[model samples]
Target: MVDDLALARHLADLADAITASRFRSRDLAVDRKPDRTPVTDADLAVEDAVRAALAEHRPGDEIAGEERGGQVGAGRTWVLDPIDGTKNFLRGVPAWATLLALVEDGSPVVGMISAPALGRRWEAASGRGAQAGPPGSPEPISVSGVGELADAYVSTTHLGTWVEHHSRESYLRLVDACWENRAFGDFWQHCLVAEGAIDLAAEPIVNPWDVAAVQVIVQEAGGTFTDLSGERTFQGGSALSSNTRLHDGALALLRR
Candidate 1:
């Protein structure tokens, strides 16, 4: 068997190189997907680079990417989101990241998120512990110990999506109960939860590519990652990641 985690990290490195080069390039091209979300040349380039590397290294593995779709085979499947925060990246914000994951039989076994603009990267395998920082001096990371919602710091990508998806009331109630809340948005919010910088991070709707990498990272970092309904799967269409201590409470509030 291959060292899946190592391969994931290597893929992240490959993606980071492409994304960093085009971060704010004035000539960068932009397009819109059918869902109305933005897609940039950087996104397409990053995915293409990773896909090419994977083909050379693990040709048998299936591949699925946000910009360019591929099959999810019965065996190992690699998922890629070239840029998780394209809006932020286009706006010159430093919160975007390239997310990658290896899924085996429907569950993620290895994951990685690389944010070169922010100078950070995080990765995890099913059994190995989660880690963050530069490749040279990585550090093990874990979730916060916040046990109560009233004492917790929370984050979400956007409230408008929640409202549009019929989750606004539940989301607001949870935020009202928290000590503080921010629109940290995208992959950064969940990475923060894994790093113990925040207690919880939720999203009303998300594609598998958006949460697959972060799911394993959060779980390996001693946190609980679930959909708003409390099921622990990235395909749930939404996410609610928190320190294990606060997960149930947050889930209950969001489901009520």
Candidate 2:
């Protein structure tokens, strides 16, 4: 098992160097057609760097990334999202991150989420707990203690999509019940849950790369992760993550 957290940190470092350097560079211009070249370049570069490092260190492991598809090696596969919030990156918003996770068979055991622009990184391995903060400045964080649904805070990313999918009424009902709400899209909201800064995150639509790393971080931080229907797997295309106390309540609201 490539269980070393240091290696995870190193991989995150490789991703950060590539992303931070080009984050808001005027030369890295954005076009109206959603020129994906810049973020695509960053993605491939970061993934390639990670693959190279893994080749040298964890030679027997497989690797998968958003930019280049999947490469099956050993039973263990490293899942990566070179930039989870590509739209945010294109918009000069610092909400993007590099997400890495080690999945054995079909489950993620270790996850690392690095957002250099936000000056934060979160890392977790099965049974090791989750850690987050600026590089080299780690803090032990966990989910919030608010067990009641009415006192909870909620974050919903991609509001328009929820309404488009006819889940708007239920979502609005959820908002009315929450103490506060944030449309802060992308991985940051999930990290907020991991840091005990937020109660629940209702993500109506996302891909594996979007939630893989966050899944491990939240679970390791003592929170629950599941589809809106409450299944543990991420295959349902949406997820509801929160402290265990309010998960069912949040799930009930989302399902309605």
Point to the candidate with the largest TM-score: 1
Q: Model 1 segments beyond 4 Å from truth?
A: 71-73
Residue-by-residue lDDT tens digits, candidate 1, 1-256: 4588878878888888888889988998999988899999999999999999999999989999998997555789999999999999998898899999998888888989999999999999999999999864679999999899999999986778888874778988899999999989999999999999999999999999999998999999999998888899988899989999999888888985
For model 2, which pairs clash? none
- State, as a TM-score between 0 and 1, how close model 1 is to the true structure: 0.97
Q: Give candidate 1's error at residue 169 in angstroms.
A: 1.3
Cα lDDT of model 2 by residue, 129-182, tens digit: 999999989888899999888899899976787977539888988888899998
- Listed per candidate, the RMSD to the true structure in angstroms reads 1.2, 2.6
Please give the lDDT score for candidate 1.
Answer: 0.91
| Predictions in order: lDDT | 0.91, 0.83
Q: Please provide TM-scores, in order, for all candidate models, with all chains considered together.
A: 0.97, 0.91
In candidate 2, residue 202 scores what lDDT? 83
Question: Could you give me the TM-score of model 2 versus the true structure?
Answer: 0.91
